[model samples]
Every structure is written in C-alpha cells, then in structure tokens.
Target: MLRGVKREVCLSNLTLQHPRPYLFVTAQCDHRIFYGCWRVFWATYHVIWVLLSWVLEPWVLYSSSERVKWFIYLTNWTYLLLAVQAVTEAVNFFCVHSLREDIVADQQAVPMPWYLKLQWLLYNIVTTGSFMVTAWYWAVLYKSDTEIGAVRVSFHAVNSVYVLLNLFVTATPTRLLHFIYPVLFGVAYTLFSALYQLGGGTNIRGEPYIYRVTDWSRPWKTLLMSSLSNFLAIPFMHLLVFLLRLMVGRLWECWRGSGGSEEGETRRGRGRGVTCVDLGQRMTESSSIQAELLVSCE
Candidate 1:
C-alpha cells in the first residue's frame, strides 16, 4: 500500500475505480511558502538565463537592433506558464488546507470557472510540450542558428527539462483530448513566424527566418515538407507527456495501494489500502463533479 500522508501532506478524494482521483500533498499547506518557493525558482532561472544571454549574445534581449519579440516569445512563454502554475498551485494548496481542517469540507462545493480549469490543463500540456519541442528542434534541425554553444545548448537542452521534471512530480492525470491546446499553441507560433517573415521581420542576426528552417528564402517545396514534418512533431510531444503522466500516476497508485487489490477486489477487509466501491457510480461522479479538480494534487 502507498504510505499515508506525513504531517505536511494530506491525501483527499481517494477512490478506487476506472478513473481514480487522489490528491498529491504539497510541500506545505500554506500559500506563502508555496508562492515563495516558486518565486525563488523563477528568480534563479531568470538570472541564469539573463547571464547566459549576456555571455552568449546580447541580441536576444529587447535592447538589440532586432525586432522586439513578444513577451510570449521563446522561453518567456514557459516562464509565464510556470508563473501561472505557481499562482494556481498556491491557491489550491491553501484550499487543500481548508479541506483538511474541515473548514470547507462540509461547505457546499463551489465549482471553479471552466476557463480556470482549462488554464491548468493547458499549463501542463503547452509548457512541457513546447519546451520539449524547442530543445529537440534545436538539437536536431536548428543548424542555421549559431552552433549551439554552451549558453544556447543549456537553454535548449537542460533548461527546458526544469518544467518537464516539475510537472512530472506535481501534475495529476488529465484527459488525453486536452492535448489539442498544445498543438494549437505550436501552430499559432508557426503562423506568427510566417507572418513575421512576410513582413521582413528578422532575428538578432538579422536573418529572415525565426529559427532557420522556416526561412522565407527556402524553396516552397522544402519549406512545405519541413513545416509539415514539424507540425506533426507537436502531437508526438503531447503524447510523450500523456504517457509520462500515465506511468507516474499508475506507479503512485500501486505504491500506495490506492487501487483495488492485486486480485482486483477491494481491500477493505484487510484494513490496508484499497476499498472497493461501485465502479459504475464512481465513473458517473468523476465524469460530472469530481473531474472539476478543485485543487492541485500537490
């Protein structure tokens, strides 16, 4: 069976069924600590990225002769995603605290806004998948950019993994279809790049292409083939996240014995972990109310 919560951690909404819901305990039940840690991590990463950008090349920043990239550009988008996660998780952490304290446990359930829920889902999907794509593309196809020296290499390769690993330990299992948002995010960026090229907007090196493969100077056939291939890569990255969540969730359930017994029966008799409830009813509840996700698992 999975170990029970420690003093700082509490598990809620634990049920064994086709679609299981279990809360991940945060490092703290307090909002301040949660927010403080996020700020620390954010500050550390931004400092490093800035130092690397300065060392490697100054042009990536806004003051350069290059066009001013959107605040949503490049690594900044993932940073925004992280910021959103920090805010949402901090609130959820406090909510879980209230739930455990029995302050809100019996109160009438207040549903979260649909957009807020959607934001959480997209935060997981887009942030992780986009960073993965950035790293992979730079490693494989981004030859026209300066040979990825140490700074570029770290930004693309090692730095992207920060969000990936963070989400791995923090996120709950969301449905597979929500992955479409990440695909849309990639397509939107590609469309923006195409428009920028048509307008003759260039990068720091004053190159017409944002990342080289989409260079306007490329033959129509070459660009078409490359764009198509790259578009397909987005969904693959989404699937990678899906599989990672599934593996992590399953491992957690098994280790905790949160699911039914190895024989697929409820373990209520043993007074251990699993408790068999009516699977049919649980499915209906998950589909309706429980799936709303009132708090972060962590």
Candidate 2:
C-alpha cells in the first residue's frame, strides 16, 4: 500500500545519516555571510553562560537545607543536558571547520559523524526537556519554592529561550521519530524519581517527592502525570518545534531567492527532508561559499 510505503519512508528519516556537515555550521538558507559565525557564537556563549550558572548554583542554593541534592531535580538534570548540548555543538563546529579540507576531498557520501549524532540526540532532549521543565515549573510549582533568584530564572525560564533560539536559527534536521529521545529522557527521569521515592528520599522541602506532579504518595496520579509528560507533552513539544522549523525553513528559502540551476534545486530540496546528496560535494560547495564570502568581506 502507498500508506505503508510512506510510513517506511518517514521512519527512515530517523536514522542518523544524511546530516550534511554544513547543516551544523550554516543556517537553513546558507546564503548569509555571518550565519555560521553567529551559530558558533551562540554555542560559545551557551557554554560560558552555563559555566557561570554552575558556579552560581551553589550560591543560589546556599540557603536551602537540601541544596546538595540539587542534581536530583529534573530542572537541574535538564539544565545539565543543555550544558552538554552546548559543548557538543561548539565542538562539532570546531571539528567540521578543522576537517573541512578532508571532508571536501573525499567524493564519497560520508555518513553523519558519531559526535554529530550525539549532538543531534542531545538537541532533541534539551529542546523538549527544557521547555517541559519551564512549563511545569511555572504552571504547577511556581510558588512552591520561594527562591526567585537568577539561578532559578536561568534554569526555569531562560533555558527554554536558549533552545528555542537554536531551534529558530539552526539548519539541523528534525525527524518526527526523534521525539522518542526526549520521551525516553522523561521516562528515565521518571523512573529515577520513583526509585528516589522508594529509597525514602526527600525533596528540598523535606517532602518525599522530587516534584509535586511526580509524588509517589499518590501513585496513580503520579503515573498519569508521568505518562502524560513523557508520552504526550514531549511529542507535542517536538511537533511544535518541527512546525516551527518548517516555517523557519520557508522563510530562509524566501530570503535565499530562487535559482534555475541544478545546484539551486538540490540546495532547495534540503528543505523538504534530508536528501542523500554527496557529502563531499556539499562540503566542497560550502567551503567555496565561505571563501567567496570572506573575499567579499575583505
């Protein structure tokens, strides 16, 4: 059936292949001169800001009695993932740039690198996880803690902004099936919370729950919330990001302008989905574009 074939094709997109190296560094349109630099700058900035947050976290929780258990919370865990994502992205750009010549030399289609795959997985987790944490904290647990400090705001609020900005700008491909990563992340955290409860752990407030929604006292309620969060909320967030990416892609295409050349058509086809164009060719083209831009700027 056509439906079954289409389903298979859709699932194929989830595989960790076809991610052109240029996608990591360049924007979707890839026309702008400063786009790659701007992306690297954000990655570097995220690393610096996250490091600063780590330093300030201890001070922020100095007054709390169970401050040492900060890592037990979902918010902190998500923030830590965000930190990893930021570092991975920065390193990805470095590798891509450093090995540009090598990448361009090999005419074969190179599979997406392992580190790039890790970065992409982390991207899925933090994008949805950060937003989930922010939404849950603000909606359900806003007044539970009186700690309205910069650390709190940064973790619960600005984290979403950081990921959303990346989502809006990056050319990184998103697959419908990739929603499973963040869902698995949520499930893993949920299991950890349950185990923490079984171990007679207490929250910062000395309550036997990491989160009010995830409290084990009411097992059924916790199960419902956890299921909804992991299964429903994460998928919904992923869909929202996917839609946003599509819209951003359209805008980028519009800005890029149309061309009648075969190369232009190939470049434009990337917006539809991850195409299996020759990696070496793509990298060679990307390098040439960068060189041209540099010469123009000078």
Candidate 3:
C-alpha cells in the first residue's frame, strides 16, 4: 500500500510540471537542429575566409612592410583556425547524433556522450584562438608605434575582464556576450580607423585639423545629416582611445615628477625619452602576454 502511494505521488509530481518538460523538450529539439545547420555555416565561412585572403593578397603586397606582413599572417591564421574549427564541429555533431541513437536503443543503461567532450574542446579552441589573433593585431599596432592611449587600454582591459567573467559565471550565459561582441568589435574598429586617418598628419601648432561642413545653406539637409553622423561617430569612437592616452600621460607624470619641483621638470623631459622606449617594449610584451593569456584562458 505504501509503495502504491509513493508511485502515485511520483506520477502526480511529474504531471504537475508538464509545461516545463514540454518547453525543455522543445528547446532540446531546436538546439539539435541549430547544431546541424551550424556545421554548414562553419564550412561556408571557412571557404569565404580563404577566398578573401586570395582576393586581398595584391592589396596586402602594396601596403607598408609592417602592414603587409601583419595582414598576411592574420589571413593565414584566421583561415587555418576556422577550417580546423569547422572540422571539429562536424565531428562533434555526428558524435552527438550517434550517441542520441545509442541512448534511445538502450534506455536502461545510458553511457556518457562523446559529443559533450568534443563540444567543450571546440569551444576552448575557438575562444582562445580568436582572442590570441586579436591580441596579435594589437601587438602589431603597438610595435608600429600606434600610440594607443590609456582610454584604449582601459577599454581593452574592461572588455577582457567582461568576457572572462562571462566565461566564469554560468548564471549569465556567455551567449549573451557572444551576441553583443560583434557590434562592439565593429564600432571599435570603425573608430580606430577614423582616428588613425585623421591623426595621421599634423599642422604648425601640432593640433589635429578638425574637419567640419560649415555651410548652413538649404537643400543640404541629407548631406548635413550624413556629415553630422560621421562627425559624431568619429569622436565617439576615438573618445575611448583618447581617454587611454590621458591615463598614460597622468601615469607618466606621477612616475617622473612629484608636484612642483625643478627636478620634476628635468625628470619629465627624461621621462619622455624613457616613455618612447617603454612603449616599444610594452608593445612587444603585450604580444607575448596575449599569446600566454589565450592559452591560459583556454
């Protein structure tokens, strides 16, 4: 009688959450479909990267020596990484399907799935490889004396921490971070390119020449709007980099000279020379640091 009551209670509990089980089943089915489709998507992207490298080869050659080498390396590494990832993902998908069939056939004694291990491995490889490549690009910029200020540094630091934190916290899934990552990357690249172009040349007073459309005439509303957008975006994008520079400047001052000393002024001048050397060193070090971090993160 007790055993019968226990069975009835168990059945009642299971029935009580019918909607939740239904939702879970629906999600699992959708995920399985998405996983299958993603294999083709990965393959398509791998081919695209290869083709892009071939197309850009001529332009890469015509660029500066530093730029040419970096671009070529970036292209090669990107293609290799994507190709490998696609292969791994494909294998993982097949393993998952096979394991699911096995489980259905032998429901009384289900073995652990091979696909879970493969999925985890692929995730580590992709995330680490991507981060390393990004760091390598930055290192190239640094070695070229790109002069990334405190604002840019801080932004990167924050971005890195945020990504790592997401990885650590299961509660706030990394998918959320992945969704926003591309947008952040696009905006940062746009701003960085604009700033590099605008700040490339200098004038008599050593101030960057601000470009603006001064005309207030009619029938130029569309042009005016376009111009405004460009102007806003450029500054907004550069603001982070500029802030980084400000932070570096303050750090330099604090290191070289305490306030209000003649020796401080002398130290400041000396510090400038040291700063140039330090920047170069930091750039080289950053590349190695990035490589190490990527491995560690993985």
Candidate 4:
C-alpha cells in the first residue's frame, strides 16, 4: 500500500508539471508593454509629436522659405527612423518566439490566446499604418503643388482608419478601450509630432498640439511624456491651433495691405512728371500685360 501511494504521488507531480500546448502561443500573444513604465514612456512620446506638428511647424512656417525646406528634410528622416524602430520591435517579437522551445518544455507550450493574438495584430497594423502615412506626407512635401492636397487627404484618411481600427479592435464591455485610448492617442500624437517636426510641416489650421522640443526633459522622457500628455492636452491643443490660425490670418492680411500700400505709393510717385509719366504709363501697361500673361500661364 505504501509503494502504491508513492507511485500515485509521483504521477500527480508529473501531471501538474506538464505544460499546455497553447501556453507558448498565448504568452507570445499577450506579451505587450502596455502596463507601468512602458505605458508612461509611450504616452510621453506622443505628446511631444503633437506639440511639434501642431505648434512648431506653424511657427516655423512664418519663417523664411529656406528654413521650411530644412524642416521638411528633418521630418522625412525622423519618420524613416521611427518606421525602422517599429520594424525592429516586430522582429524582436518573432525572435523571442523562435527561441521559445528552448526556454520551455514541449508540454508547457500552449496555443496563443485570442487577446494576445489580437494585440499583436493591432500592433502590426498601427505601426505599419503610421509609417505609411508619415512617409507619404513627406513625399508629398517634395512633390509638386498639385499632389500635395491629395497626399494630405490620404494622410488624414489613413490616420482616421488606423485610429478607428484601434478603437474597434480594443473595444470591450469593461471599457478597456478607455484606459488604452489615452495610450493610443499618446502613441499617435508622438508619431505625428515627430513626423511634423522633422519634416518641417505645420499642423492643419484646425488641428492642435504642435510639438516643441522645450516641452521634453530628455530624449526618452520627451517621447514618453508627449505621448501621455495627449490625453489631457490634445483638445486644448486643437483649440489653440484654431485661435492661432485666426491670428495668423489677421497678420497675413495686415502684411498684404502694407505691401499693397507701399507699392501704390511708389507707383504714384513714378506717375508724377512728363517723361516719368510716360515711363510710368508704359510700365503700367507692361505690368497689366504681365499680370494677364501670368494669369494665362497659370
């Protein structure tokens, strides 16, 4: 009877130690940096991006054309860098999975859990989608004026699609999406901000939260804080952009009026004397013809 009990105990221990087939897949699927420090870092990155895109670009737009060109160049490089980072992370995920067998016994490897699989899928979608949108936006900046509008539309559409998809994919009755929504926004804002700042592109007038370097404490901290700040700041940023655009419009109008007044005064002074009048009349006619010619060319 004692020997029989010893054998039963051994069998029970073996059964308890046996690994499930789905465990490996499930672990892989669920392995995401969603909680704690990861989430904090993610949030910070986005907040910076948003601030750059919405604020810095517009401010820069008021600067010289040479500066704008330099800005655009910076943005393109930044987007490419970010895309590389995302791809690297994805590769790391695969690398870990490949070595799973060595880490765990065959019996313990379980199938992938549904939620973990979903998370992985969403990660791929968001990263790829963001890369594509940012790349296109940069490309458009270099292209002719005619293509810029279309490219802008495409960027917005892609962005909307990804954001909505994220919402749908993560949605749960428990309101898990709410907790994660802030995180996602932070991520998007960071990406968007980085692209905007590096590209030298300004935010759309109605959009807000232009990224600023001063807002960040350090490189990594900036990335994380910017992302996290999106939850509280994005709406305010939007309002700020709107008001800023209005102010910009007023300033532009004033500048245009001043320029027009100066030109009119110069033309009138040139119109005063007989020979000068003839020259002025001829010049006026030439200017009219030039304007017509330009209009036709357009």
Candidate 5:
C-alpha cells in the first residue's frame, strides 16, 4: 500500500452492478500489456538514434576524451537504461501476465518485490536525466543540420521528445521535494566537468569546457550567469514536468470517470447519478498504473 492511500476501498456497485467489473485483475493485465508495448516501442525507436550516434564516430567509444563529452556519455547512459527497461516490460507482458490471471477482484493487493522497487527508482533517475538532455540541448545548443546526415541532427537530438513521451506514459504524481533528484544529477555533471578540466582534458573541438554555454574562458559575468541559469533550469524543468503530470494525469482520471459514469448510468437506468468519487474507485488497483491507463474490461 502507498503512504497516504486507503487500504480498502468500497466499490461494491462498480464490481457487482457494473457489467464490466471495475476491478484490478482485468485492469492491471490490460494496463501492463499496453504500457509494455509503449515502453518497447519507445526504447526501440531511441536505439536507432543511439546507433546513428555511434556510426558518426565509432572511434569515440575507445577515445576517452571524445566519449567523455556530456552529450555522448549521457545519451549512451540513457539508451542503456531505456533498453533494459524495455526488456523488463517484455517480461511483464510475456511471463507475468499469464501467471497473474488467477488474481480476482477481491485479491487486488499484490506484493511487490524489492527488485521491482529498484527498477522504479532507476526509472525516475534515468527519466530525469533524459529530459534534462533534451531541455538543455534545445535551449542552449540547437544548430541546423541541413547538409550533413550526421548523428547530431538526424537522430540523436530528439532526447527532448523522447523524455516527454516517457513522462506521458508514466505520469504518477510525484512529491515536489523529490525535485532534488534532478538537482543532484546537475551536481554530478558539474563534478565531471571539474574532473575533466583537472585531468587536462579538452572537448571534441579542443575547448576547455564540454559546452560553450558553460565555458570558463568566457567573460566572468557571462559564465556565471549562464552556469547559474543552467543549474536553476533543472528545478524549473522538473516543476514543468510535475505540472504536466498533474494536468495530464487529471485528464486521464476524468476520462476514466466520464467513461465509467456513462456506462454505469446506461446500466442503472437513465436517471441514475454516478458520483466522481464512485468513478475514482473504479480506477483503484495496482500502483504501477494508478489513474493512467486503467481501461474498462469490456
């Protein structure tokens, strides 16, 4: 059970009176199937971009200097994280779905393993880094790639869109203070920059800094302003993600609510009134999905 949620919710009418039983057994199965497909599709789509990036400079993998670039390393890390998640999603679809069928409406509480919780933790970290890659790149370092079919323009630069798509699928309302995760990511990257400089390493173009926006060679005020703004942007972007989740997540709830109300009314006669709270109970199930893709069984 989650921290602030009720242990037992009374949805007697939804399960018994409703034609399509508004229950977790069927909803969780279908939710896992649909989200698994989306995760696989998103992962596979980005894998192409990862390959394109590697093909651009296969030598980078072996070169410490080239591979250490913020863009290169972060993108590689993001791809690996997403690919692993794709495999997990496949397991859920193929293996767990079959074994889980014995679960009925009454036995909705499923014990989650420690590994599953670890995966969710990794999911948050990888996703936060993924979105930052996109937001920072687009805002500070976007250039046209009209002539060359290189990795920078063709496939590797869509991290912003990829992150947004992931957020859309898994929009569980997170705690505001948890914004520290992304801030810590920024701090770690700053440490990497410090180490890179300490090691007498230079960026791909032989510049002292990884990105032009954070170059130490720039004027003092310029560098300070840019660095401060970029760091601050991390929290701002997280807030935006939170806001997006709240807006989109509510819409998802309302969608389920409206659908349930219409179906429930049709069954219980035209004069019947379906409360929003009653409809919300229909969405109660496994925390993996929450209100996001809890579709009707029928």
Candidate 6:
C-alpha cells in the first residue's frame, strides 16, 4: 500500500498533475529566504525586463536595416513568448496569493485552468527555444564586424539567462515527455521559413533567405538544418532541463533536511544523506502537503 503511494508520488513529477496548486504560484526558495519577498521581486523583475525590451525593439529595428522584418526572427518570437509567460506567471502568483487563506484552510485542490496550462506549455517552449537561439546565433550567424548592441544581446544572450534563472527559482515541474512542445514550435518555424521563401519574402537586405543557413535556394542544406534543430537540438535541451530539475530538487531536500530540528531528524532515522525511499518516507512523515508536492523519485 505504501509502495503504491510512493509510486503515485513519483509519477506525479513527470505528469502535469501537480495536486498542490499553490506550488505553481510560489518560488522554490521563498519559504527559506526573505519570507516571500523573493517571489515578488523576481516576478516584478521579469515583467519590467520584458516590457523594456518590447519598447526598445521597435526603436532598435527602425534604426537598423531589418525594419519590419524584425518580427520574423526566431529571437523575437521567443522573446514574445517569454513576455507572455512572465505576465501569466505574475497573474497566477497574485491570484493564488489573494486566495491563500481560503486555500490553506480548506486544503481543497484547485483545478489547474487552461490558461495556466498554456502558460506551462509556453514555459517549455520559451526555455528551450531561448537557449537554441543564443547558441545558434553566436555559433553560426555572428559576424566579427557586426555591431553588438544592447537590444541584440538581450534577445540573444540575456534571454537564455532569464530562462535559466527561472528554471532554478520557480517551483514549476518539468516533464521529459512534454518536450514535444519545443519540437512542435521548431517544426512550425521551419514550415514558416519554407512558406516565406515560396511567398517571395526576403530579409533586411532583400536577400532570398532570412539566414544564410536557412536559404531555401539550397533545398538539401535547409532540410538538414531544420531536421537537426527540430529533432536533435530541441530534445537535447529539454532533457538537460529535466535532469537539472531533478538535481536541484535533490540539493534542496538535502539543504532542508540539514536544518531540520534534531527531533525531526531522529524521527526520520537519518541525517543529511538519504536514499530515495528514505527521503520519500521522511517527507511523507513530516508533512502530508509536502509529500504530495515534493516527491520526485525515479
């Protein structure tokens, strides 16, 4: 019977079934640090950074040769997705915080809404796509003489920082199976590139291709690059994220257990080090709420 509960708890980490809805809106380290200030500050910073970038993008584009074609770039698309994710994240946090009293008192599970699920989907895409954009741009598209401006850095490099920080800070769970979102996003962009070529679209300099590597004029080369990015790169990034989440969770558990009361530690019959089952049982014995939300055994 206990094995069944542990199995269920372990499986919950891989699925979108996060029973404790409150965890979605809270930061992973919020309880330990400055009470809850970290959540507010981080969420506000995300909102401000995205808003500033949105305002600057137009000015930067118009000043450069890209002009209206700026929106067609993958960097900008990922940036827009990140902006939406930030807004939705802040909204969910505030909404849940307002209902904290009722949610805590009743302990009733709130159903995850469609928009929140959409936000989670966007999170997966933005995180993976942001890193891809950064790596691809620097490795392939960057030119020595090209001007390296703040806006360009924000879109390419800093964007990855946002997603990486989000990975470690948020209490959100990442699933290995949900890698399909980034794969689909990559496929959609690849399809759009082909359609744009057929439609006689051109880049800023009126070239036939948006990027040299994606030039549809060379059909075989374009196809190869598309397949590599959509299949190979996206899946690799998602797997890295999934592993990082598990490692971070393990470190968090170790840190918390070290500071736990001596009586609580004695009750668990373990100190800092613990096996998977021992950790699961310890969490289960300590707090039923935590057991439902925190267990991530494999």
Report the C-alpha lDDT of model 3 over 1-298, residue by residue, as the tens digit. Answer: 1221122223222211111111111111124466456555655655565555445434355435434433223224433544665556556556546655643232323433444433433443334334433453464334555565443342233323322332331111111112122234334433443453355632222333212221122226534543443344333333332233223433443344333223423301322323322433332211211111111111
Backbone collisions counted per model: 3, 0, 6, 47, 0, 0
For candidate 6, give the lDDT of residue 209.
Answer: 77
Off by over 4 Å in 2: 1-9, 29-40, 48-67, 102-108, 144-147, 258-298
Alpha carbon lDDT of each predicted model: 0.47, 0.66, 0.34, 0.34, 0.48, 0.67
Off by over 4 Å in 5: 1-32, 57-112, 144-150, 153-157, 171-173, 216-231, 260-298
Task: Indicate the worst ten consecutive residues by lDDT in candidate 3.
Answer: 289-298
The estimated TM-scores of all candidates read 0.61, 0.76, 0.31, 0.25, 0.63, 0.76
* Better model by TM-score: candidate 4 vs candidate 6: 6
What does candidate 2 score on TM? Answer: 0.76
Candidate 3 is scored at a TM of: 0.31
lDDT of 6 by residue, 60-137 (tens): 555454566766777777877877777777766666667565432324356665655777888888888888899999
Q: Number of the top candidate by lDDT?
A: 6
Model 6, CA-based lDDT:
0.67
Worst 10 residues of 4 by lDDT: 289-298
lDDT of 5 by residue, 1-298 (tens): 1221222123321121212222211222235557657666766765666665666755456576565463525445555665565455445444444665433222324444343444444555555666766655566666666344555542345555665665566533333334566567566666665566657767776777666665545557544754574467766766566556544544444454456433432211222332344433433322223322233333
Please identify model 3 stretches exceeding 4 Å from their true place. Answer: 1-30, 59-75, 98-100, 103-119, 142-298
Model 5 gets an lDDT of: 0.48
- lDDT, candidate 2, 1-298, per-residue tens: 1221133235555665543545655554554346646656766666676667657756365655465677898888898888878777776766676776443333235556788788888988898889898999898889865778777888898888877877766777665577889999999999999999999998877888888778899999899988988899899988777666645544444344333122434442432222233212222112221111111111
For every candidate structure, what is the RMSD over all alpha carbons to the true structure, in angstroms? 9.6, 8.8, 26.7, 31.3, 9.2, 5.6
Cα RMSD (Å) between model 6 and the true structure? 5.6
Instruction: Supply the global lDDT for candidate 3.
Output: 0.34
